[model samples]
Target chain A: MSNATKSVPDAEGRFGEFGRRFVPETLMEALDQLHEEYLRSKADPDFQSQLDHLLKTYVGRPSPLYFAERLTEHAGGAKIYFKREDLNHTGAHKINNTIGQALLTLRMGKKRVIAETGAGQHGVASATACARFGLDCVVYMGEEDIRRQKLNVFLMRNMGAEVRSVTSGSRTLRDAINEAMRDWMASVDTTHYILGSAVGPHPFPMIVRDFQSVIGSEARQQCLDETGQLPNEVIACVGGGSNAAGMFYPFVEDYDVSLTGVEAGGRGTQPGDHASPLTYGSKGVLHGSFSYVMQDEDGQTQDVHSISAGLDYPGVGPEHSYWKESGRVQYTVATDDEALEMFQLVAKLEGILPAVESSHAVAHAVKAAQKRSPDEIVVVCLSGRGDKDISEVARLTGIEM
Target chain B: MDSRISAVFASLKEQNQMAFMPFITAGDPDLAATQQVIRTLGASNVDMIEIGFPYSDPIADGPVIQASYTRALESKVSVSQIFKALGELDHEELPPLVAMVSFAIVFRTGVDQFLSSCVESGISGLIIPDLPGDEAAEVFEKVKGAGLDLIQLVAPTSPRERVRKILKSCSGFVYCIAVAGTTGERERVADSLLDQLKWLREETDLPLAVGFGISKPDHVEPLRGLADGVIIGSAIVRRFQELADKTLSSEDLQKELTKLAGDMVTATHTK
Candidate 1:
């Protein structure tokens, strides 16, 4: 299927068997109204142009596809490339999707934007986007995450977004999502749920992937121009699998490009020790879609452990599920220990301290490069920088500096 | 004897019938009154009881439940107190009691220790709202060993593949979150989601129990034929809140609960 056509939602706003408005009855009217507004805006060229302008001028669109020469030489094999999403204005690839959704929320005549954040990356991005659009923004974060990711909380507040610390459940991403959803349900009249990842219910995944496709679209052309051919393989870490979905979309049709998703393996498969849903999870429903999830036999969501806060989730994007079932892409796990070692290795070798979330991809790339030939090329999406992870990494590795 | 949860399902299949279930947050207004409410519900021929373990911040719960939680916490109801009170229930007299709690409470208590205590305290099942299926394996194994059911919630937002996976791991009954939002009272459950419930029923032999926003009697009426049971929470709690007065005698509270339960049971049978 054509990338654009594959990415767009169907008439009912679903992707394959995924994506439906399964909200409460009180909010059903609001969701229908939202669906109507989204449809109207989708056809409006002016709306699309405004969103595109923000993405390019405000969020720094067309992020670089830099060749990681030093790391490639150190690995002593395949040439490695990095999609510089860290160069985005908000310091992560999340801004691209946030800017698009925030614009849509405004066009729909919504006055407030509500979002759930884990590790605060998505919250910060949403806050930044809302601020730029002059929209009222409220972000829900797990109380524990608020304590750990204080910097992000500060940044979000500085951007003038109201930060609500969710103390229920594990006090993590899932709890934050639950709280944000409750707020949206109550205030659906004037609010938009700016889902962070390529998850939630149906239209969210489809919409997020569409906004982030710029990553893959840009990287694909850059690769072709650099090597006169597609890269041999592409690697990205999968949390809710947004960045990976974005980077993999343009390349899915390329039969020659091998796509690999690196899931956080935490310490190991010991109970309560990892977030590698695809590697360890069975097919289950979560966040409004059916896909692989880390759950117990009774189908209760399990507490997912990961070194990277962003990748600490039990479910992934639905499109990833489709791609996974179709055998179009491969999935693997990278342990916290392995990811940590790679995080340090890349920092020392390439001077790039990637976000712990992106280090999983770096870990896999290091292993894959060792097996591939020098002529082979492996492009890893360096989704975000590691400045946010310095304290956690130090505590994890016992490195004071 | 009124059918135990297991026997209720067995008889339902034999008679080509379904069971009625109603959920209420324990200690919503006051401890004594809430206990009476539970006893009343048990006597009403309800299939099973879902007793919410009130947390300070119940993220998955809406405003009604949040208010109930505030009242419960104000009453100083600790997890220990909940177990102690449940331990007082005559096992033969009370219906099967399942604890619906958030993960924070369980994690703080320690998963293994909590399951062991639950088994000892006469709790037959647990529905931890925040625990994802994959991460629940170890806890599931422990709960299974202790002969307790670890119930799973399947939300409207859940994908089909997820439903199958959750069904495979689930025990007791499968909880279908009829709506996307948290627990609260609603006028009606959407007809479209009923089809999703039907889809889950075909995927597993386990009895399907629908919850979330099931406040009124009419909400459970339609599910009588399609689902194995129905669960209600916020509406019952609201009833207790309305009745709570410093001077109300225990007998008076029990009478109120009995009246509410009788009305609910009558609605279920008639609808």
Candidate 2:
């Protein structure tokens, strides 16, 4: 069908040929069951109300839309605002999706939940939710990530989730995903795979985007109430594009508002240097969807490098690729240095430390605000708090704190 | 059918024997060694051989096969390289070669392009573990258009209606997953697999082969009357992993592979 309609992923989960259930024969029925349950759960008022209660009292909803007055003056053009997802429970936007999926797991009657994590934010969030719901939890993380994200590992383990280290190809996020899928396949009857991002097969991208849309809905109303109009630009950093999709999806029909996605430009434009697949990669299937992937000449997926473990992935969500082709959302890149600079600046100016993953969006917003008129407004999704990233930043910048 | 897969199954039927398919990851340890192993398996009593094209993310694979892919990929094995190496082999010395690849690899290389390369490389059939039902028809058509069989898998969890629909487009033999899990060695074949195979047998006259957790001689013994073929994958690949750790000579490695193939061949041949 046409990409113009906005209602995408028509029966077979094709976001204009970017998304599909490319999993094995065994999980097909599970995916079908999940899709059916998700639909029923969406329409069920009890599910909505319970999730709403958890979001309000447990995770804290309607996160404030704060005016970054100092950063706005620093940009010297447009007024800047931060959608404070960092203030939510678990110190990140990841909890938003995990809570919804945990509820789904219970609905499906699965007693165990498995997930893959790169930066540990999703793992911590999933573990936290599983702990609350009294379900068995397992988080597969790359050995390299476990070394780097020590705090998050401790957090996940403290919450009673088993942290399994993956020592496979690249020893990173993709490998963790592969391990988690394998685990899910072997334990499909008792387990639910809580995929962290807006990637993976059909229903997951839709599922995650719907769960995360709360960020956009809240920001939209909050922006209109605060500024008397919609912001001219909305920006969020994209790894698998969940946060960005959540923040941008509500504004798709608002043609006047520009939706921008910033990717990780790790070191340079050389192959394997960046995780910006949407900017420079070919279409291929990975995980369970056909999307833009960083692959080499022989179709082997290339290793992606980014200082931010969250964005160090070879592929983006299929919906992001579709939007890129549709020209609905403008995709850009922020180098590690740019993101790092923004990370430190936000802390010094606003007394708020942002995750390096979210700082990529802030870095782009800085540029976008500078290019816009003074009357225009920009809202940047502060996707997560940077407490977990402090050690990595210290190691990189040679500062203890 | 003129396909080598069908021909092999027909010959097996004539002899009152079951097909023995052994799986080896291409370029595991290295491409030369992988080719050597294939040549050895081909010369042995194997009716067919399945070559796994190593992928970064083999989601359907268990620990052993997944590790095999990692080792192969670490050695820089690519789809083009695998095909080129296979093309250099003397086809007469090899069993009918079937490729087991992930959809990402096929999609990246282009569907028609991948299938054509398989034809050029002497591949007779394909088993894409991740190309589930909804997208199988289009890919199966492309594989068939390239004059190759797109082998279908019937899992233990598949309902009768799903199995019936899957068998309709299936070519070669229907791959009956002996267990609900990914490919790995198991102590015993579950009794439920017989029921699944029995259900499939009622639906089609095509040959049925059991795989996924079929690893030992005992595993093959039980499937003698139930299945037309038995696939042994992770068990064989696990041997390769064990031998690689010892840094055995290439000839020795081939000998080990041949001996392993012989044992499974003997088991499948008996009764």
Candidate 3:
């Protein structure tokens, strides 16, 4: 925050030395065109009004910044607040981006959309926007994710989006992104690729972050209105880091707010045992963007693991890489056990079933909150709801749900 | 640019012929098979060979080549091993070599190591499809400084301004993506190929090599006068897949591959 880091990516989309387009020549012109269209759309008051209206009425925006009384008391130190993105329609912050991209898709006169998803929140959100706009949609999902995220898959299909199962390496989010990119390469003329997170080639990271920044912008104002000051700590889970980038962006100038991102540590610190790219990975390219990636010595992407499907990606957003390099944000990790425990604890104590991805932040917030005095305020972004994860969690816990 | 690459193109031009290059993923089926593939194509009158350094995510390639990369990775092939294996080859017997690699690998393996490896491996030129041509000046300059040609790709969808920028960064030859899509075997070349060729011929002095969907021997005849080289990717590699499947014997694979290469070579060489 407060000029601690480089400004936003340059005209060519380089975030310092990270986040340049590393895609095939076939997609470069289309990327330039998309970046131009997005800039115009961002400035158009009519487009802004339409998007704002949808967020406010259709998605129930200004999602509450509620003080989690029980979670705060249990931490026994700092007061904790929850940025309730879990309450947004489609039950995640993903819709904020999908709706925004969908508007751009229409503006560009594209009638078809392609997307890839991990935890299914992005898929469900993409499907919702497509169905609402009467646009053709296809969402690529990894076969492994399909088995675990059946509810979201069904939701997408029922909403008229075709969910293609990718059986490539790892059969997870990374493979899905690869497959979606291939589709984009072939269908770019009439299709707009709705990348689910603040990753991928140029303009996508900027676009997704701009749309999702509503989360932090609102949380900042609401926190001030209710508590009369900015929180000392802003914590969020990072998986492609869409929500975290959005939340961190608005507070980047608020020098007093300490930003922390919780990455999925899965089971352990070994290479394939976790998905914490920022903590354990080096700089490389994945899914069209230069970012921190879980790659071997020869730059082959490695298989990564996490209990939360959304947080199982092998690459982080380019902005996160820049932030890491600039010392603007402190990134930490939450192992599967810690996150699973918080999933249950938050459900019982706070009457909120946090998506396992957000449960990672909940797990870390416990430690961070305990470290601070009662006078300090710490806020966690509850990035999504856990409805899609109930069956997976039941199976993991050996319960028949 | 390497002196050998220029000599190869100049020789082809003197013969009133176009160069023929066949591509295969380096570690597919195994490095031994890849080495054999290079030798086979080399002996078949092919002008140059394009070896793919397998990447985990090869979005620029179609399903056939993508499968080859997957198979190569399953064997746990490393870039060092590939370089070592190729280094052991008799460059005297082979044609000029180029590698179609992802920029991610080049970035991971620093510029000095990568170019040194290329020199050690007898690779004459480089075709990195995923390196954004518009943002490639820095690496392009580094590669040019190392005396290795980093070929730039110009696609059918490229805006003219972007095309001009990309052309300035090219060396040795320009890889003209014959189609507006990824590398694959297609039924026909686009109807606008002649116009694109004419436009590119007027814009830069770099030799034009048409790739991406130039699959068969027949594809060569059509691009004869228009392009300086013709690259056959998935079609040639598809036979290697059959070799790996064991449905085709080594002897038969050689005969089939040799015949395919012979046909394209003949067509490319004939005015």
Model 3 stretches astray by more than 4 angstroms: none
Provide per-model DockQ scores. 0.09, 0.74, 0.78
TM-score of each: 0.69, 0.97, 0.98
Interface RMSD of each: 9.0, 1.3, 1.1
Ranking of all predicted structures according to TM-score, beginning with the best and ending with the worst: 3, 2, 1
Winning model by TM-score: 3
Candidate no. 1 TM-score: 0.69
lDDT tens digits, residue span A74-166, model 3: 999999999999999999999999999999999999999999998788999999999989999999998988897788888999999999999
| Cα error, candidate 3, residue B194 (Å) | 2.1
Clash number by candidate, in order = 22, 0, 0
Q: So what's the TM-score on candidate 3?
A: 0.98
Most lDDT-accurate candidate: 3
Evaluated at residue A359, the lDDT of candidate 3 is 95
Candidates sorted on lDDT, descending: 3, 2, 1
Q: Tens digit of lDDT per residue, candidate 1, span A1-401?
A: 32322544566555555444333333444555666776677788997888787778888887888899999988889999999998898789999889888888877888899999999999999999888889999999989999999999999999999999887656789878778878876677688999989876556787788788889999999999988888999999999999999999888888678999999999988658999888888665565555677765434567789999999998888788777767778999999988888889888988888888999999999888989999999999999988999999888778788
Candidate 2 chain A: worst 10 consecutive residues by lDDT?
Answer: A1-10
The CA lDDT of each predicted structure is 0.79, 0.89, 0.89
